[model samples]
Target: MKRKMAMSKVPGYLVEVDHWNNEKEHTVLLAENSLLICKYDFVMLRCERIQRIPLNCIDRICHGEFTFPQKSLNKREGEGLRIIWDRLREPTFLSRWNPFSGDFPFCTFTKHPVLEANDKFTKMCALDQFMDQLTQAVQRAHEKKPIPGNANRVPVLKHPILIETYVGLMSFIGNQNKLGFCLARGNMGF
Candidate 1:
């Protein structure tokens, strides 16, 4: 089983943490069939949760500045990549209340931290390369689909999602910044 999984990894792709992971970095693996987010405990590097998003369902990908209402507290400062799929546009009020509500249809990505420290790691986890690879994988997934129902629809999710927002409550700030993200502080109060 492990051997099969190893064979499925999309070459030239490796770990690059997105902002959704908060302060702690998460390993993101781009497998041929799906995108996997591996959450690990910092101390022992034990895998706690693995959230997988299949490539076929991906409908849109956007790379741009993080835009929010002018007065929004959650407005972040930088360009980010958002990967969207076909699903409900908004989350329910109750679901938004959940700290672990990472079940959103889209995943936003930011520059990986490791890229800042070393140029070698930067190339391995380059955002542009990742985006290109993801686009190719999505195209392959859609092109090979044998579903009769999808025959009439577009054969590929080649659209770039640009709609940021007009104005409304900011849900992404809380939803993406999970409780586990910023739990660690270096000092530890000696």
Candidate 2:
């Protein structure tokens, strides 16, 4: 059967990486404040000193600095830490487009039989919630109140669910039309 295409809109965060070790024990020393990590191959690094090294060579390590956009920082220490960590991780596609806008999108495919399998989808939901909170914090900082029921004000997509539903609906309509056409043809043949 031919496969159908699907897409989704999601929010992403940036992360810094301190260190990572491959199965063969090869290590990649990434930016100390980077959050995005190799989920299957390596574990997240936790260290006292965060450093920035050349993307090509680890031995070329050096102290690096990053500055968040003005008015983005707030009084909450925890929020600040999370935002900084997320920025390091590189969570969303929009990160590259416009850091201030905080818009991003992501899409993936799966052949699993169970539709509601909890994996990346759950993570996406959590990230959406986090983004919503962050947006609210930003609004509050501007002396504005968050709109009721519009927490994230961001689009979060559950890819598998969306794909399945779309396919199912299309299939149902196609089958019904085919049945109706067959019935009409038989009546005319009579």
Candidate 3:
């Protein structure tokens, strides 16, 4: 079988859900002020950043095992991190199906199962270090957000992972079709 491949995360699973619900490979760009998600453009041979989350807007940074609703078809089980900046709002059935909806308030990341058995990916993996740096940066940025008079009342960044899911839909088929861990070409002219 021909193995399909994309940019691989060495530590654990790091799957990013696209707007269409397809699992896509992304490079995590850790910048001083914002985190950027970059996608590799095969033709350009360079990663293009497609999304940005400002550090100060981060209201929470959490780590835990993924928890999905029982009916979710694409339930993923593994320890992961979730970054949230905005408040989560309940989705209406109509809004849930909207293809052009705005971005979700949070991003979820977990260790890739494929890397679990690969020794080459283990020895030097520094996800913990990365998280430490990120947490510090977020904390510093978070501290700067409170107004002058209410320093003590500023909301502390919550460390608990809160999942906001509406049964995985389009991504279910896409995940099933992935070539190995990366997204794959579909049989019908994918």
Candidate 4:
């Protein structure tokens, strides 16, 4: 026979930490209430009875050597890229303490029972797929090269001043065109 009880939820932000083990292997640490959740294969570490370390106070452990995915951005692509970067850099669910203030609408769920693990796994998978697609699109855009101009061009003017002015104007026009293309492709509302 199976028995179940309603799970109580805690409130806090979810942060991921990477640490290197003695074997120099990277491991992700997820902590809540002093209980550390390592990789699926590692044993869970219980630090609850010990002094609780404030999330902000914990010195981030840096392994010095780590590979990070590259992202591309165009100047014409306004606030969208900035917003995405900001959200990823510091993600936090706002507390719904004051309803009048018009804060976060969704309720925060921190401590759910193991029975809901399947649902959590599905959500995590969806998030990972979405991020992967975003990263690929950015990389492809960065790899694209600018169009080549006339190679075997004829000299239209002999005056040095005229040539310099004409070249400057051409450069400006080319930049404007590139910026316009980026803006159009971005489909930015603002």
State TM-scores per candidate.
0.67, 0.18, 0.63, 0.16
lDDT of each prediction vs. the true structure? 0.54, 0.25, 0.54, 0.22
Candidate 1: Cα lDDT at 122? 72
Worst 10 contiguous positions by lDDT, candidate 2: 17-26
Model 2 segments beyond 4 Å from truth?
1-44, 47-125, 144-190
Across 1-190, the per-residue lDDT of candidate 3 in tens digits comes to 9754332233222455433445555556566566765565434465554678877777666766556555655665545566666655544666555655644676766444444456765432334544666677676665766423433221434353434455666567656766213333354222
Model 2 vs truth, CA RMSD:
22.6
Error of 4 at 105 (Å): 33
Model 2 over residues 13-96: C-alpha lDDT tens digits? 222211110011111122222212222112233222323221111111112222233443211111111122112243444444
Q: Count the backbone clashes (under 3 Å) in each candidate.
A: 0, 18, 5, 0
Off by over 4 Å in 3: 1-13, 18-22, 42-44, 88-95, 99-102, 117-120, 123-129, 143-169, 179-190
Could you tell me how far off, in angstroms, the CA of residue 190 lies in candidate 1 after the best superposition? 17
Q: For candidate 1, what is the lDDT? A: 0.54
